[model samples]
Target: MIIEKLLFHTFIILAPVLIQTSLLEHHKWSKSPIFTGVLNGLATLTCLAFTYEFAGLYWDFRYVPLIIAMVYGGRKAGLIVLAFMLIGRTIMGGDILFHGLASAVIASLIPYYFSKGFWKMSPVKRVVAAQFIGLWPIAIIFLMLFVFHLPSQFLSELHSITFILQFGLVQVLGIGIAARLNEWMVEKKVMREEIIKSEKLNTLGELAASIAHEVRNPLTVVKGFLQLMKRQSKGEEDEYLAIILSELGRAEEIINDYLNFAKPQFEKVERVHIKEILSEVSILLNAYAVKECFFGEPPGG
Candidate 1:
């Protein structure tokens, strides 16, 4: 019977986690800090609503969601989720409401203060730290019970080693699962960026190759004509010929630089009109668009 309740509650707690994971996977909203905070806040509220009943008291992996929000989403997310939980608990109005509110505040701070250090820690340490941090809220609630001099039955139920250990284990497992999911999301994002970069580099290489081939042919023709002019020039024109030859050599060097995938540096900087570039691009695109449309039309029409 005890094991069945634990399994049922575990499933309830994880349902939101699965939904949250799917949201992260499908939507780009996670990139926005505010949106991410609001999303995680909703997840925490869901966890709260599905609390597991034990010994006439409620327990849920509510802090698990908040910890994840703060650790990965930062202080903004933590505070937002905390606010949601506190507001919901206050509205519910029970003897444990104040205790729940205090625990929620502590839970928010644990990740806000330690998230940076948590990420820096080894994987084993991270799991250990998460478990410890995750369970601190329950610890606080128990302490508050003693402090408030709650009824004997309430104290007795909480005081049981079995209850403590069971709940502690739940916290540890939930934290571990949340932390792993966070790591997986980060890895997926990084992998996507890397794939995009590789594709861009490949496209750049193809463009460079095409430009080098087309430009080299025209440069070669121009150089050949200049060499012919130099050979036929008189003494007075020789200085001008030397200047022309030198410029042609520089142009060849620029072409070679392009072929080698290096940026061509100009000896003189000149102001280029943006309108001229736009006009050139427009003309080129207009020709391609006309050709494509001409072919796209029906044979009879």
Candidate 2:
């Protein structure tokens, strides 16, 4: 019977995380800081709501939710969850209310202060870190236990040594499950984003190939006409035609770059003289400037 209740409470504690995983693909704010804070705060509230009687007071793994909010959502989220925790405690007005508040304040500081480093840790280290931080609140509770100096019989009878140990172990297990679930959720989200990005790149590649092939066909027709003109032209006109053909060839190379998106083919390395390039550009610019009258001085003036 006792084991069954503990399992039930554990389910209540983990209910939010389990639900978030089920809606992993659908939720928009599932992993946001404010959302994380709200979810964990809801978990704390649920734990508080369904608390079981132990040691003549209500008991729950509410702090595990608070720690989780801190670990994943950082300090802002931790404070949000902490506020919910304090509110719940105030509303309940149960045994040792002030002690509960004090324990919460003291316990929460550990995780809230150190959450920045939590993401840098490995999964195993994260679980261990959460477990270690979870122990602080429990330790605070124990310290309160000693400070209040409850009767020896009350301690021995209501909260036996074995049960106390089991409580600590259960909190440890609870935090481990929370942190692990978060890690799993993050991995799934990352994989989905990668798939989306790959698909977009593939779409862009296909578009480039289609457009390049279409443009290359028109360029081929133009090149054929230019070659015909090159054969018929004389002297200076022939030189100008050659320059046009050279520029047409460079345009084809650019189209090839677009067509072969997956793998690029490099052309043979040929030594190019600066004088020939400058002369070609100057002649082309001079013709364009005379024809269009767009340039006031022309290139390389």
Candidate 3:
């Protein structure tokens, strides 16, 4: 038990450091690349310090550092760290099948709380929910022990329920911290978007003024041509009148568009097909096409 316990704790303590190295060395965490590097270096050293004093208690306590890495860093960072730790633990001949598996599975479950889809949710709520969900394995472990009545030498109770409860509590705390980190990251991203949008709006204002001035000449010509076409057409040609009216309506719409662009407001954002928009523009301008090719280009080139 002492050897197993020593092996577990040492493995857990070094897990974060090794994982951090992996991330930094491999350049995996792109959101804050430098942050991952520095943090990994610092965390590895910190865990090394903790291992000297608490080496015997490491196995049961490994989750604490795992949770810390996840919270202080992010879910992706946490997973990388956890993977390193699991591999390290397995290599050290500690908790390879059951305990190791449990820890890895539990660690994997932590990230779902702060996944991209869950970004809108509060981190605290996500952590609480994850803790609740993650505790099921502990329950299952206990039931298995009870049903099988395992040999005392190998699977003694050893304050089993109490230890499991403690493990759950530690995990909950770790997850809570991680969620806060995610929230901070989200707020920063929102602020960045606002800045970008403000700059875009300013640029749009200048462009709108230029567009309005340039479009005035075309609009006037269009109105004049519509008036001439209407006068030339016989009164019975309803289709010609309809075409002229639509052209005039489009001119009016362009005037409104200039006003809107000048003092732009937030527009509804939705998915649009670029090809469809291009097709619409082509159909609108079909009347302007000439039979002669420009620049003396070969036909169909």
Best by TM-score: 2
- Model 3, TM vs. native: 0.47
Write the residue-wise lDDT of candidate 2 on 1-301 in tens digits: 5556667767866776787788654778776778878888988988898887766556678888888888777898889999999999999987688878878888888998889888888878887888888898788767766676675765666446667777778888877887888788878888999999999998887787888899999999999999999898888999888999999899999998767764545778778999999999999888876876664656677
Q: Is candidate 2 or candidate 3 better by TM-score?
A: 2
In model 1, pairs of residues that clash are none
Candidate 2 overall Cα lDDT vs. reference?
A: 0.81
Better TM-score candidate (1, 3)? 1
Better model by lDDT, 1 or 2? 2
lDDT of each: 0.71, 0.81, 0.53
Compared with the true structure, what per-residue lDDT tens digits does model 1 show for residues 109-222?
767888766678766667677767777677765676566655576646645657667777866786777677666666677899999999998888778878877888887888
Candidate 1 segments whose C-alpha is farther than 4 A from its true place? 53-57, 115-129, 145-159, 234-301
Candidate 3 stretches greater than 4 Å from native:
1-29, 32-61, 64-79, 90-124, 131-171, 221-253, 260-301
Clash pairs of candidate 2? none
Model 1 TM-score relative to the real fold: 0.69
